[model samples]
Target: MESVGITIRLFGAFRKFGNGSEIEISVRCGTNLKELRVLLSQYLRENDPKFSETLVVDSAIANDTKILTNDFCIEKSCTLAILPPVCGG
Candidate 1:
């Protein structure tokens, strides 16, 4: 079976998703950003429900930029950065 690896960088309130700094997650080749978000949500929910609740409450995934699968193809490397909504005066 083929595997895909990605380094997810969490920013702002989203940093609570994983321990310490960034998180490295492995997914099957061909996984899209939407799927990745779901997987990430599961990991966060297991590790910290407070972060998970925040993610859900704030609709974090919905606001994320679409991340293409490497070359926009399945079976390729990809990176994702999660950030919370920002507002300015």
Candidate 2:
């Protein structure tokens, strides 16, 4: 998995993996963030049935240092942060 080298940081209540606030995931190089969301959704739904919705919609992804669209292209191994939707009145 080290060869893939994609680090994901979970924020809010997204850390379902039970390993602090960060985790390392593997994905094919050049995979877009949207595609990554689908991959993550599949895993989450299988492990935690409650998370049926894909991350593409349920959360925002911070690519490197900026909040980008799901279609943002991931060129190399980098750190991504998952932020649950902002809800407040």
lDDT of every predicted structure (CA atoms): 0.62, 0.74
After superposition, which runs of candidate 2 have C-alpha atoms over 4 Å from their true positions? 1-3, 54-56, 87-89
lDDT of 2 at 19: 83
Candidate 1: regions farther than 4 A off? 53-74
lDDT of 1 at 43: 81
Worst 10 residues of 1 by lDDT: 55-64
- Give the TM-score comparing model 2 with the true structure, all chains together: 0.77
Clashes of each: 1, 0
State TM-scores per candidate.
0.66, 0.77
User: What are the root-mean-square deviations of the candidates from the true structure over C-alphas?
Assistant: 4.5, 2.9
Candidate 1 lDDT (Cα, 0 to 1): 0.62
